[model samples]
Target chain A: MSDRGHLKKTAHLAEVPAALEAGPRGAKPRRLVSTRTIVVYGTLFVAAAYYLLPLYVMIVTSLKGMPEIRVGNIFSPPLEITFEPWVKAWSSACTGLNCDGLSRGFWNSVMITVPSTIISIAVASINGYALSNWRFKGADIFFTILIVGAFIPYQVMLYPLVIVLREIGLYGSLAGLVIVHTIFGMPILTLLFRNYFASLPEELFKAARVDGAGFWGIFLKIMVPMSLPIFVVAMILQVTGIWNDFLFGVVFTRPEYYPMTVQLNNIVNSVQGVKEYNVNMAATILTGAFPLLVYFVSGRLFVRGIAAGAVKG
Target chain B: MTGQVTGRATVRAHPGRPSRLTRNLSAKIASIPMMLTAVVVFLGGTLWTVLYSFTSSKLLPRLKFVGLDQYERLWAAPRWLVSIENLAIYGVFSLIFSMVIGFMLAALMDQKIRFENTFRTIFLYPFALSFIVTGLVWQWLLNPEHGIQSVVRAMGWTGFDFNPLYDSSIVIYGILIAALWQGTGLVMCLMLAGLRGIDEDIWKASRVDGIPMWKTYLFVVIPMMRPVFVTTLVIIASGIVRVYDLVVAQTSGGPGIASEVPAKYVYDYMFQAQNLGQGFAASTMMLITVAIIIVPWAYLEFSGGRKRV
Candidate 1:
């Protein structure tokens, strides 16, 4: 109905959407199944399948027994789905010296991720609050360097970090990996928090400052209390990112302390006797399960997190 | 959206801008972590590695300089050459396919369709998984014995042969496939946000002007979304450079090192072979590659002022 002006006056009115021709207020009613609708939905359906295929295949393959996997093609639905592979992968599948399977790595990941996420987010939020409200003389320079330095390939810094860790007596320990994650996680989280804190009502910060609140006073009492959504977003990003990491896990921690991703890689690729495809798929899913759970459960928040995190150009 | 961030990035020299470092002591202390990370870890670590690349360091970093020797040896190695080639192939195709397919999916989703959230969730779920998991899943899917090859053959196409992971010539493409599957969802999400950010008035105006949707998209919409596209380009470019664990879990750089990447080269050289100089050189090259792409973009983004935003 808003397009009525264009329809009455414009020479190219015929080119407007057919819905405008229905001349009704609100939505236009059309055939439920048209050629264009079919094509659009059809392409999306095919794409959704392509995207979902691996997860489907992984689940299907993991459910079948090894004997069945040997005989059946990968795509076929299991004749008899079994939870044996899931149990085996979680408990018994070997990664070299460790026959405790993925549980050890999973716990290791939890240990690394919790501390890393908390420390990184805490540091970044304070940095963000400082930059936004308590702007120091040379603070912007360091923040700028941090953002730009994020693009530098981690390979260049990996060795130097090893040296630093060795000097600090944290090398090959889980603590070292936590520090690595915190350092790497800083740039994005800082930027995320910086923009977020800046967007808050300026009156809020000024009001606190006028009330004679100091730096930590305003931050802990005023800023942190008001930014729960942002904290959740940062946590989502760090937990998933730190959990999915392999290079830092492989480099910073000894084999006995490998994270789930690294250990999953080892168990699957180690050329063990009687290559068990079912167990392999189950272990793979187990490794990916946490982040996937977060992604699904958080839904829109996960999108917001990545959008904020990845759009750091 | 980024306009708002860029606008807020530079807090002006009024109200909040604290005078001198002595003031806001707790703020400075709180910022010590950011400073140490930016200085010690990022800047110092990068410089330290670059300096050490000149030395013939092995098993440990030593300061004995042998200028250009490590770089020379790195370029001469056949494996290094192959890694570079694989990166180029992986980079070019990954960029093109990711942009096009991601945009296409986003455009379709922008058509005001049903189940948009369902479709988006399905597409993005793979991105949540680690590269290690993606690699292992694809390795199983591409296995010649019981994966895609046998499945296709079982459908009466006995001549079917689609084993990219096993064949040296196409093995990188195999990795490329998994990479795209895990990645393009993020790109689509970004592009969809960009599409949504485009004022609806433009679409209405284009319709009134009798412009075809494709023409409007190519000439008007894409050009308008320059910042988003550039940001995506940088993200994908940086990611392509660091594709290590995927190759490791999928093929372990084998089918005879056919799928080696620079990141993997650095890891193996430094850690496994204990050849620190070689790893240093390879990693320096990686840094330079990123700089070549990033520096100019950062310059354009910053120097152009907040006018674009």
Candidate 2:
């Protein structure tokens, strides 16, 4: 209590000189109480409200009956709470003849995402290892090109990629999608692992080399274990990016292999007839659930990974 | 005596030069796969895109040379023009708003507050959700007939009218709001890391001088966090160019193409509108515009003016 009293006195004393210099003589100074905390919390609360308002609306809309949603009371609870829309969104909502809701796209997304993540991360790690550990000729040039390539909007490359994939007879296939994701993901992934590797002490690689380990040997036995944090970060990023990818999935995959985002888009953006807000909300939530789960569970590691140079490039 | 021994060691090391050649050869051989990845995938993809932009390619690649026709159409199209214009506005607003709001959020959380992790997670959960979901959710919330407007009106406040999404003039701002919601979390996280990484001595020194926290953050802390800020700016700029799904999901470039971003325009023409030539041209234009803006920035960033370290 005494320390608190002292803190208040000192805090007041710190502010009085500025007030005395700026305000009228003997004017009652405004309370020098710590409004910093008030302003901070107030701004944060407003921001959080702004951030979470849509999520609240989505949840409320999803829970409400269609009639209630149609009435436009997005914040109000339905007179009858029903999970029917969720059921419909998952099992029976029509996107063309496939009325199996977004579940149709679920397996396709997993197939696309799993391989894309693995191949991209594996390639990136190898690239990162090679660039960081090996002083090979033109290594710097190769790294520069790769980093610059990351900044090129893939939209620019999309038309050309379609042709290239078509020429290789891989166009509109799962493999094509995988290859595209891998190519696009490589820059950021390589940058991530490269930065992580560069930050590591070089002695480890030297020791591995002295032990007669080849390039791959040093990477597998030493670098992989040591780079778990960066790898987790890579996986989080690749998973989210590739899984949520709509354009690539639409362009590269055939109809059967459409990812959930694509399917959700079709369902929600259907230009014909009335748009069902309830079903759309449910489907949107369903489609986003995986990444949201990953974010919530691994947010701390994600932040750490980013701070550790996963996103620095 | 040590110098004489080292000289003798150098002379001895010269004899193993032939074996070193064999090792060098092996290292060269091992680099081939990486070289192929860079040349074929990264460089090849980019080169292919550039080449195709010149061709009159459709759903399938027809290699007929169209020269500057696609580029001409891209410039002439009203939707394409709108897309470019919308992107510029969206980019500026989203970057500034997200950075300011994110820094504010991070600063507030940095005050050693209660439930810091909970608040951080809440702010960040949006980033985890795809732009698709963000767009969908926000679209639903901002819909005039059925969303926040009607909900508030139902609460007996008849003057409540929040329908930015439906208004052609301001719908891009609606999309920007959704983008900022997702993006600010990332900025907050990055800035928080930057804030936490700040040397404790600076804070201690400032406290001893009786400087307030606000002044310290404004004058002292932010300048030190410049690298982090620049990194955030580059990342956010890239996100701006890639602004496809959010606009597609929310407005569908609706209310008369108000939110038509370049990516979406290219996509619509390439896929639905069946104008592949124009689409590729638009794609090329976007690529060039982005390159024009970003290449210089990337060069400056990587060229050691502000080194990554």
Candidate 3:
């Protein structure tokens, strides 16, 4: 096509090619499927298979009857597919005294994840706002310590947090777990929100301050509205993180209030009965469902969040 | 970024008139959680644990110092020694393999392939699952009687021995495989971001100069991605020190504590055995390990790289 014709078509579309190129990093435009293309695709396909194999096993194993699982190869398609294991995994799998199943743990995870995510994001966003916009003496030092403290293994803080929780009279309760999640989630969430708020248009913040908006006023009226995407990113992070947390859930809550991951582990690892591989796989999938859903639904935002969190260093 | 500096400058100019405490009172109140967490939980908790490591507290934390007795006992335990060794093996292999595989995957994904998003999502979805789920899935897959061993035999291979979870010697490698599976996706995503950040013109220049793709990647691309590599190394190292739940779910640190790691050691000592001092000592050692990895990196990152965005 002529340059003028190309300009005419693109000018009406009002979309620049650079804008399309700036989508997710990979996917540069290529011309032909040559030897190089075959090699690249072959390598990616093999690696993708390696990544997908366990998940496929989980799904197929979960769908099979126990007798089929016992007799057939794990790699084969189930001769007779059944959702009985899924039903059992959700309602009847045993974990010691808990014959009630993973549904109870699922509820417990919901109770823990929702409150923990909201409270943690709330505290971290406000703290991030204060750090980025309202500079006070020695703020960066605390910020640095918090970021560095994130790398401190949970082992170092686990017992100490237990003591603190006990002293506060909230030990082994859902409230204690929520508080624990908030405390641990603070560093990364705070860093995430801080960097985000820092990257915002400074003029809007300055203009709001010049209009005599106080700390909470400017935050509620201006920053919150402007940073909704960040809030979603924070929610994505915390929901997946707090939901998938086995250590804190095991450490902070009683068995009756165990999160899905903990209960799933107990149910699978408990040695009292016959090893139900199908039921075990079903329980694993059920426990993993929430984070996997979040990952698939908010795919790009999830990537952006982790990338932002990692690059903040 | 700019507003913070100007805000600081303004505060500095008017420091004496308002007095530091009253200035930005609302902001300070807002930051109380950050301050308390920083000072009390992070700084104080770490210091308190390290101090208590020298005592003989059991079932409770007491201040009657025993002068490294707990450390001596910790170092003397066979389980703790095994845990340390497992962590070393797990850490080194996980680091090397995750970096290598992650980079290779990222490089391939950068080749303008079709369905890039689909490939990325598939590669990364395993990362979304918890270690508990990862462990269980791998446990079932690695089970000798019903898993890969039996399957291979059924396919007419009479003798194929591929059971890592049962063998005490290679149990750590079993855990390592699961770790790499669950983690490398994040590393790949990070590497892809680094590759994308490179200017396209650079690739054009390399192609014009008749540089082979492998040579270009080795000599030019990898060096340009130094920061990404360092960041990934730190992230992986930190994660390696915290490999507790994966071991617990996969092998429960058995066939006889062969897959035990430091974090598991601390948890068992602190909670199960009610030996607070021993847990403190082991946890403090974990802190020391992280410090060894983090401090110098923090120095180089903050001190010499002010120009970084």
Candidate 4:
């Protein structure tokens, strides 16, 4: 009895620190601001500046002409700022036979991203719901396998996927890339939805079942409405990952359906030519515009989604 | 009474056990399409790759058994060795630096400062950009003649030489820094979420007790975020292993294979070098190495009987 009492006390002691660090249980205290706060904020300001420096340099360089770039005070305002580089990068930066720049790959990326995101998210939601709510033999085994698949590096899978796609006559097509993204996106998306669903009141699902709602009906009525936040989060992650992808896009897609990332790569990563700084910076900014816009607009919601997923997972 | 009525109704509706069994069987049958997708796409694809790594193939993937010859050649290749070394250096520095910077940023952001969203968006915006574009931007920004070097020279402080991208000895470090720029924001976001989820009451109690902020964070807050740290570490590890695009975009393993990474080496052999057999062998070795490192960690995670993101 004494030993058990001691163990309980030790556990209680552990809980105390946890509660203390989480801040006083209730009510905001009167301001007793410390110098440490200033120090912390100051450090953050400096770090933010460092993080923003590369972007500043990219923007400034992109605005400069070749002559100004050559003269190169990258931090200073360009002696003659020009949007000519942006125009050239948009329409005339050479990759191969066509000099029509990254604009060509824009629609190709869109066509790939939209359908892939929807299908993957839908499939993942179904898988998550079934795994969490339905009791079936070998369910845990399937979930384990899916989770393990996430750890396998894409490099290991690339050769085989290429062969399989080739065998099916779908290699180097936009459809092939879509399938690849969907397969890769499954583990993370499934994990997200599964955890989210598990956190929801189990009684809600039980009550739905009592109402004679079948599997699809219960999922659509109860789970889908509650899952809006997570769905948006999944979409954000997929759009960013799919749009920014270069290796899979380059290797999987034929030259005709190459995404903007490939064009951006060709423009800036030119090996044998006179390196064009202005064009490279402009191309990069142009290519990155979409995802950056998404993040900028939905910044708060994105953070909240991440926080919710983190806490629940 | 209601339970009896439902039980009788269920019995009356189903009537025969054989028909009930068939109904259950049909439901199972209806689920086959979903199961088939999971199996064919994930398991089948993985198995096919493992099988191909054993074959002697090139360019358009010819399948003929060639024992361990390709693996032998891969182990002996100088460029492949260089690629392995570069990746090791890049992975360690990038992971450490990004984690440190990200954690620091998150701790600061949790202090409830002004313009929190602006700061967050600024830090995280890079993660939204494709590394292909970011890598190019870095390449241009780091160029010897036209970038930081020229800018410094023109400022009349001609001794500022920051041309690691062109230098054989220091080029990989340049790539690592660029990768860190793109990666740190993701770490910050993940860690910030961890920080925020930390109950607010702890801050107040610590303050009331006069436990200094740094000490409180170090001893109390950081320990509570173990799961978040694990998730971030795994994600970063995967990123490190598959780090091909940025290198290709930024340096092309340039200045005589200075910044070559293992993925790029495998890619070159598979496509440009037209030695698919050796490429597969290199990939097999990488898979083995990654598995050796990851399997134990994965086992521990799963063995805890919890699903981890």
Candidate 5:
């Protein structure tokens, strides 16, 4: 199928002499319950158990009454399952002075993620198109800086960004967090889109140009229509990323605007009050639920998104 | 008259040619956001932080040059020392364990196994959750009374004292457990992709040569996956330096400052302690750490790019 035919054919011809000289050798067919098979399956089973342990513990613990959790070990199944912890975690869990629970944080995250994902994706898609197709002089310099900047710890830029946001009167607002997300998301998303757009047939872009289409015309009509899968990949990356963020949400926003992860941390780790492990586990699951849903639903594409990031990174 | 003027202009021009500024006008306009982000946030913000790290700013940032006073204090602080030591331990272990364990998991999965998808999904699901969640779950699991210790004790292993979160010496390991759980799945995925990229002929060739599977993976496959290894190392290293939220949620650097991390150091000094200079100095150190890893990788990538071209 490829240009390797000649090489393979030559190898086979050379192997013919070796086979004639030494005769044929064969590997013993592996039995279904061979030692190797047992080892592989056994190790995998143990790993799966280890990996699944915390989730199992979290679920059963969340369902059990406080008395049972106190008396029994974490791994045991709930003797009597109840949804009270989930209810209380959703509705009345106190995070500091606020008792409204993770729902508020959930809504805030939705507000933050929806806009941030859209705006970041919009800005980055255009950036990628320009880099891949428009080919302006010195564009690579900025792109290089952006990629390098991605590796820098957020602490270096946090205070400076706070200053900029304060000067613009958006420091404590949701919009400020949105802008921060967009800025941070730019590097990876741009790289993702750039690689993708670069891989598209070059003739398609040339034909669009030949038809007298301008930059926006080609992007909106041609690139956008053809890049639905990539856009979805971008969304998957952004949605999960923005949803899971805690640092920026804490550093940039007031408590009222804290994202779910930050709020979940606050609710669980608040120093006052009796520690409710059941409610805490419920809240933790609630906070993680959105990203897990996306990861599950977007299974292969989710893997593809991260794989694209890894291969390029 | 307008038509006559246009005609004269058209006749004078050999062909339609736009100046550089206007040639890609729409593209340039669209790139304004990218330019602003790069120039203002990435470049400008980094420069600003490094510059201000020199001053003895507190509560409010000021231009009173302190001449490394902040770094002097930063180095002298026991808490900072603890943070650095924890980070070193965490970084080394995180790097080694992640590579070894992640590769092993990936290799096992690559064995033409059934239920591969199910195993992969289970391993990676933790990665979907935030570090905060991972920390909390592990914290609950490691609780001295009601968690692993209790369960082990109940199983007649009463001498089991496995409370890493409570002990000052092993608190960082507690955080490491959560971080590895949250991250190894990603490393596995990357390694899996790398494994998939190897040519099928390589495997057949190894088999024909009667090489053991482990030997093939070790001697042949690994050498071919050098680029992926380097990339993964860079990623894991950078992430190691930024380990903050997990520590915060798990132990909050508690039982004293046993689990203090550099990122947490920066945040606490800046926001809580109101010591801007200390925070700036600490953050600058973090930047230096990242640069140490990223610069050489960039050089390699640049060279690799040339070779590919």
Candidate 6:
């Protein structure tokens, strides 16, 4: 009886923080169904159908053979499901000179995305850590500028960045594109990490500091372990963001290094093709697969990341 | 022996110590990249582009001063005017529709429905897709021969005309539909977050006062969610101005450039036509448009907050 009582006390103690975290909107009142319930469910169902329609069409169209697509209804389930389109999309789909398929672009995206995500997150995380923990004169001003700069459209900075890349002899290369991604991604990732680090327990930081840990030492040992969730959130934001990016990829890289989105666009919308609708839909699905996978796997984190971005902005 | 000598040297140097600028040397070093991006890329680049807009350079940027000549030519171009008109139409419709639809969906989600996560997941998955993917999927879906038009015709409507991609007058609306589909989910998420941020007590109080749910959402809830609405508005507005990739994939600004946007105009002129001056001018105009939107909002947000504080 005493052990159970002690366990209950500790559990209640833990829940206090969770309850405070939920603020005044903690509990949702239970209620019975009424007209309002029906109305809400009906509206949500319709909206869900609207949102899911495209994905459904894409899948069904991708599965059907060409003749089936040409004759039958798009809303219908595939009469004859085929994997040939997926195989073709992954291997033999043409985008101008290249018929090696989206594989090349996929590889290019991986090459670009991996390094870019890492570098951007590393730089932004450290910068965020510094800004949040180590306040110096003129830091806030620069932080403000960085935040405001995010609102500036890419067109304003495109040519200038091109010039900078050219001067550094990295223009038209994957390296240049990686640098571009880092620069553009700095604002959001920094904001994310900054807010996260700021929210961490100051006592922990002080405890580590008083134990003779320096800046890098404290960060590497204490802060990094404590903030793994934030790191995951940052990774999700960057992976999906840099993967889905079209502007920077188109701007900073040459044709050989074009990312998946670019190649998909070219293949699907190339003016001189016979317009293979199945292959195009398959290609579209393929291009979206990575981010969609991330979204599905880390669903709530995706929401939290975007919500943090939106709220803070 | 070397460590002892170094320690003695450091102890001797500590009498004077370092300047304030060098106090947090590691932090200052870590922040260089962000500082350079903010100052050089954003501020310096903006100023450079704006300055170059007044020149008459072509093929490559030059310093030949031409005092608003490029802007004059930009205004004279019928394509730019059409782009502006299309943007206006797309912007207004998208802003209205996304907000209304997004808010309605959020309000619905706030009703404590079952399968809330499933519904939200379905709605927001598209937002994960790139604009290119969104554009291509919609393009195929809206294709007259194989898409909704054919399906509707086969449904015995026989005379249904639903091809917006081909019609210049309503082409932008087609893109608007795709934009709303791709974007409203994010807006809904933002709105839902805002809705959740509201205190549950407010709802109870409104219930006690005998207010309808819709009325509570409107007269009570929305007014309280001003910040969220403003943030959503800014996000949607900024996204509207950069509606390039969708147009590129969907229509390629084609059917005689009916759906061309400012960003596309800048890219084509700069890279394809080799007219740097015109591209710079058009880009400057884009910056001005953003400033026009942002300046007043920033004033209201920052200045108003100061008074409250």
Interface DockQ of each model: 0.50, 0.39, 0.49, 0.39, 0.54, 0.48
Q: Across residues A218-290, which tens digit of lDDT does each residue of candidate 5 receive?
A: 8989999999999999999889888988899999999889999998999999989899999999998899889
Q: Which tens-of-lDDT digit does each residue in B177-218 have in candidate 2?
A: 788877788889988988988976686667657687789999
Q: Kindly list the per-residue Cα lDDT of model 3 for residues B235-281, writing each as its tens digit.
A: 88888888888999999999988888999999998999999999999
List per-prediction Cα lDDT, in the order shown: 0.89, 0.79, 0.88, 0.76, 0.88, 0.87
Q: TM-score, each model?
A: 0.92, 0.87, 0.92, 0.86, 0.93, 0.92
Worst 10-residue lDDT window, candidate 3 chain B: B1-10
The Cα RMSD of model 6 versus the native structure comes to: 6.3
| CAPRI accuracy category, model 6 | acceptable
Q: Rank the candidates by TM-score, best first.
A: 5, 1, 6, 3, 2, 4
Model 1 residue B255 CA deviation (Å) reads 0.9
Question: Candidate 4 lDDT, tens digit per residue, A1-313?
Answer: 6954774565446556555776776323323345666787788788788778888888888898888777656777777788998998888888867678878888888988988888878887877777777645665666666776777777777777787788888899988898888777777777888888888999998897688666677778999998898889888877877888877887788888998888778767665577777888888888888988887877876665544332211
Alpha-carbon runs more than 4 Å astray in model 5: A1-28, A310-313, B1-18, B304-309
Candidate 2 structure quality by residue, lDDT tens digits, A273-298: 67778888899999988988887778
Q: List iRMS for all predictions.
A: 5.1, 5.8, 5.7, 6.2, 4.4, 5.9
Better by DockQ, candidate 6 or 1:
1
Backbone clash pairs for candidate 6 read none
Instruction: After the best TM-score superposition of candidate 3, give how far the Cα of residue A40 lies from its true spot, in angstroms.
Output: 1.0
lDDT of 3 at B53: 92
The local lDDT score (0 to 100) that residue A117 gets in candidate 2 is: 95
The TM-score obtained for chain B by all candidates, in the order given, is: 0.92, 0.85, 0.93, 0.86, 0.93, 0.95
Candidate 2 regions with alpha-carbon error over 4 angstroms: A1-34, A306-313, B1-34, B55-67, B204-213, B304-309
**Best model per DockQ:** 5
**Candidate 2 TM-score over all chains jointly:** 0.87
Worst 10 residues of 5 chain A by lDDT: A24-33
Question: Model 2 misses residue A290 by how many Å?
Answer: 0.8
Candidate 1, residues B152-224, lDDT tens digits: the string is 9999999998999989999999999999999999999999999999987797788666577899999999999
